[model samples]
Target: MSDVTANEVTIRQYRPEDVKYLMEYAEENEWDLSMYDHLAYTRIDPNYLIVAADKDDVPVGFCGVSQNAPDTIYFGNFIVRKDLRKRGIGRLLWKAMLEKAGDQNIVLDGGPEMADWYITHGFPYQAYKVQFYAVKVNDEMKQNIMFKYDTKTLMESMWPDLMKYDSQVYTNFDRTRLLRAWFTGDDVRVAVAMEAGKIVGYGSIHRKPNGEYGLRNIFGDNEDVIEALLHNMLSVLPEGTVVHFMMPEDKPLPKYIQHSMKVEETAVRMFNKVKIETNNEKIWFATAHTV
Candidate 1:
């Protein structure tokens, strides 16, 4: 274990050259780091990512905050060397990252173990955990539940209404840049529920490193729309694929989905300044880092 002193730790903006060290740290600590996530964060303004380096200029920790929207910034990628905890390295990285956002509201998706520490820094927990659920997509599920609602591929022109719907559910932070990147990614597949030519729900599946699919930002006004969006997403994929989604603990899960889905994981979603309202029923999934 490395005994990194407070004075020896330095927090600064991340650079492209630091990825190799970050990847090694992530692998060493069993963090769920992926190339897609790294690429997405890199695409953002470089100033949003802050790295904590030891006296030798080796990366020991990192924290990222995305202020794509004017009034809000979402903090993520918060990690420090396991042996370096309780030494204020995380605090230094966090405080520096927070400074990048100025007065914008800061939102964080943290773990229960670190919830109290974050609250002490002014970001309070919302009294719930983000529930992660996963299920194997077999032929029977596709046949029985996926054929109920109609859906179509989402387009760039529809971003206006989509943004409105998202704003209503998420309550803060516009995902314009982030959604644009997601919808435009070659490996990402997006589907929207359509009723009388109006979109009622939307869902997107991102290709994972292991060849499975990961659901991102699945939300709808009703079960039909939500199911339709899911069906549209799965219809294009091969059979026997595994899909994973994360939802708020309070969000209602259908009996069939609940039966088919297992609790895969959990994380605490916290925010500073004020709590944001979300439609628990409408939200079926959230991204791990971008929330």
Candidate 2:
């Protein structure tokens, strides 16, 4: 165990062996650890995970930041143990992360309760709204839903339509990387909804390494098409598999999902800006963490 004075915490790159301690901290805070697993975290570039430890050589907190570009860094998960709160460990971790991040703009998804914290720390409130939902998948339902779209074949043929619709929804028009990552990456499945020979909606399912599944970037102008795509994905997964989704708060999709799945979880989208420039429009939905 490495020792540091109680007045200061030691921050360092995360080692693979640190997973046990990270999981313990997450459990203590009631935060879900299913999204991150050995494979996913290991696959991430080593420079991303930053850890803060106390004099006793115990991890008090940690943060994961993804450097998408030379000018931008996206925060993934930032947390401290419940019992260690208000001890300045979290602030130390944040400061260390920002220093390592250099001049890049840092962004994160946080809850409403933490807004004041960020505001006090020098980040402006840019936007605030999102909803999370979970549903159990079953085999019988999977067999009943029709699989009308082939993701691979469409990837080759529908590039034009896909790019057009994607730009309409996102603030920025760079879906090329995201599209490739979701459709071509391992453990990810993409499906589209079609009616009368036209693409109406699409959905992608990414099964994380820890047996948990996430519904990513589902979109459609038609409500029925979105429902169909969701139902198809749910059916293909194993019975009782829990699926989670995040969508805009004002969008009708959340209410529709709640009515269909009977389960809901709410989380706010908070932001802290290293550079301050106010925008007139609120960011209702984020295209990717990089944005």
Candidate 3:
């Protein structure tokens, strides 16, 4: 680990007082603050988030380690100022936060530019490359697919069914608390896919402050379940709205969705030391900065 304390840079646990600076960093970089807030609120422990500052006490970068389950640790929001990157600040920050994870497997979805850096440090490929897709909501696009299953607004009573599908779709991690918060939180709408009188899949749609519609979380066992959930979610959005979704590049869903949507960007999921088996084809959208 780099000795940040011995140099001009210092790494320390994040504090409530750091919110303003962190928010500014997030906004300046065009990143949504919601993801950071979500991680902060749902983190396994308070000390998992670490911030690095220059000798003058100005925040330079920050990173977080989250225990999605007791054994699965997720690395997220590792950002350094554009002017400060390539100077070892990010490395120092991550090294400090990573210690909190101990021996747990580390996982993250990062841009291609950082893939080599992460691989050099220990994280190797665990899944196919993922891409973000976007589209302007309209009548013609919404008519692209016919739902083979039915979907309804998610209910607290369906938590068990949601958990069942989540366990199958998301693999080993138990993200119940995080999923619940995201699904029921203000300005968010969740739909549950149903077939044969049981929940087969679920998805959450949230309108971002920037007027974009985020297909926040979508998971299912097959195309029919995903198509049903997506149809219900998209039906709620108004025309001309920009909708966003993420899927693995190797998955057929992207090709199906790209019939109306445009490719926005891509990222790769990497893991350190251990690869957590995940069903990449079963996911349509995932947490941008988490497993």
Candidate 4:
């Protein structure tokens, strides 16, 4: 066995003061802040946020996990400050959080590099399919598109209706807290598609600090509705903004998006479940993460 130092790091619940550090860390990494809403974080009772700090009381890494239900816990964000990497801080935090999770089902998405690390640490490779779509927004297109939706209230009210469509796409349902966080973030914008006094579909647009946008959790029945929602979402962005979408490989909407935008990158969605079994039958609408 390797003689790694025992417990040189301290792991504890996140404090309100840590939000600034978290935000700064996120900004440095180009991650969407929608995953870390201050108001929603305060509402959750259990200790979902974990931070690993060194002996000097400096936070070196952080992880956020949410209990979606009694049996399911979704892992949202995990990051290690660049300068503190490879010190086993991440593994320490992971093990500590997993223990806190008990026997509940745990789900997390990691990029190619982190996916490999997760696999080495007992997170099985479950799925492999995601397409990133990007569109260059220009002044002309912005003028043509119009915004006609109330983002805040529409997003808040969308949970139930969205759950109906989401259930058709995934076997398990445990994303309420996650959705709530996404809609509550400063960077996120929500829009709905309405027809004949009825709600048809909705789209979420997440804007990054660097002028890049991410399209998330887009749900609708028809192509026209999707297009309309997309146009509406893109209308408010600044000129030359690039909007991206990470969609499932099997979804037909990718083709539609490709016809309008360029494919930037392709990646696989890999998950590791410790206790809860995943149902692969339904069409998953959005990743919990906006990457």
Candidate 5:
């Protein structure tokens, strides 16, 4: 243990060069995080993720607030060097994180072991543990679920109605920026379903490391629309892509999807403010990071 004191470190915004250290930090700790998460978080909100630097200016610890929408952020990538745990380093990082999120509704997924700590920090309501599930996609798997609605490939021009439709569900936050930032990158693809030219639901499929694919937030007006979005996303990806996603354990998966899906992970989703109102029925699957 370095026993590095808080005063010996400087806290500042994350820099591109610090990725190597952060990646190592996450790997050493056996966290579920990946390098893609670090880069994406920074790309989404450049100034939100703050890092602790030693006297040599090397990053020692870091935390990020994924700006989901105005006054709504997903708190993640929070970690400190194992040897440098305690000694006020985490406190400094937390202080900086809090400063970056003044009065914003903070959401995060953590293990039960950290529940008390989160509650101590002002998050009292515990809704349910996030459930992570994965389904393997192939030509046969595609036939299990029928596409009952029409879905369109997400494009820059449809952002306006997309925002309006998504806002109806995530009423607490204006998630236009969050949506724009998330559904990007060459390997990322999003599918949207509309009814009468109005947005109904949307979902995203993105390539994850190790040849697997991930399902981003899968929302819709009904089960049919949600299933259509999922079907469309899966259809575009190559055969045998393992798709993983998360949702509140209590949320029911479509019957067809439930037949083949398997739970892979679970974690507690917490919020510092009042619980956000969400229609779980409309959300077929949630972004995997909740785990």
Candidate 6:
């Protein structure tokens, strides 16, 4: 292992054949990642991810780039082989990411321990830390549930205003295209909460490659709207299904969600060039991939 120098690896565009090897490295690190979840991103931009290949052209590390807005780029899916640390492969991937991102604002979530490195590199502002939690759904928690608002699924008629609401909350970008892509798959479900004939909140959920479901973009104006959107989204899924979601470190989960959830991971949210404004108090985060 000591003889394996960082020079032995070279950065290159990701290939279809490299998916299996990349997934293996990700799984070995216990990452909740799947090609199915990232498909929306790659479909929109094929060059969204890059890999560091060994001397033999075998991918040993990876990084991903996604422009959530005209001025914002999010870097994620960072990994080097579990046994291949300290050889500068990750730095190579980082340099490549910087090159791709150019002068746009760079936003990313990374390990707390590595904050200093990122700060020195470029990202120097802290927005907030976040927790990604995993929990399973069952009939037991469905009791005493009340829907405070009427929930509507995504439709052709809802496009204009839906984008407006999402843009208002997310603030950095208009996710019309991204949201459309995320809400399209057969297994995906989307809900918009309404009260007094007005939009209050919205959410979405879908099955991941690992059989667990990803609850995406649960944004609401208040706890009531959040609760309704969450319950309606969950009610459609079968029992015994595991779901992954995110929350800011300062905010607790709504009082009514009656499941024992575990924090799957933690990372500090950071930005360079600018700290984008979001309605942080009102939104339950989804994936940092686009946020």
Backbone clash total for model 6 is 0
Which lDDT tens digits does candidate 4 get at residues 1-291?
A: 122232677888887676667777877775545433545544454467888776766666788777666766656558777766787878888887788777766667666656777777667755646665566777665666443432222655566876555554444655565566667757667777666545667777766645677777777665566667766777667877777666666666532244445354454454556433334333324554522
Over the full model, what C-alpha lDDT does candidate 4 score relative to the true structure? 0.62
Candidate 5 structure lDDT: 0.75
In TM-score terms, which candidate is top?
A: 6
Q: What would the TM-scores of all predictions be?
A: 0.85, 0.75, 0.84, 0.74, 0.82, 0.92
Per-prediction tally of clashes: 0, 2, 0, 2, 0, 0
Compose the digit string of candidate 6's lDDT tens values, residues 1-291. 334458898888998898887778877876767766567667556788899988888888889988766777889888988788888999899899999999998889887888999899878998777677877888855665767788888777987878878877868667776676667768778889888877888888877765787777788888888888877877666788888877777777876554647676778889988887788876765566556
lDDT of each: 0.73, 0.59, 0.71, 0.62, 0.75, 0.78
Q: For candidate 3, which ten residues in a row score worst on lDDT? A: 35-44
Against the true structure, candidate 2 reaches a TM-score of 0.75
Whose lDDT is higher: candidate 3's or candidate 4's? 3
Report the C-alpha displacement of residue 169, candidate 1, in angstroms. Answer: 1.8
The worst-scoring run of ten residues by lDDT in candidate 2 lies at 278-287
In model 5, what lDDT does residue 10 have?
96
Across 1-291, the per-residue lDDT of candidate 5 in tens digits comes to: 455778899998878888888878887874545655655666677776788999888888988877776567788888899998877888888888788788988888777788999999888876557677777776754665545567889888998988787777777656666666766678678788977777888888777677877777788877778667777777656677777777667777865466456555577878898787665666667663531
**lDDT, residue 72, model 1:** 67
**Which runs of model 3 end up more than 4 angstroms from their true locations?**
1-6, 27-47, 141-146, 253-264
Candidate 4 RMSD to the correct structure: 5.1
Error of 3 at 45 (Å): 4.0
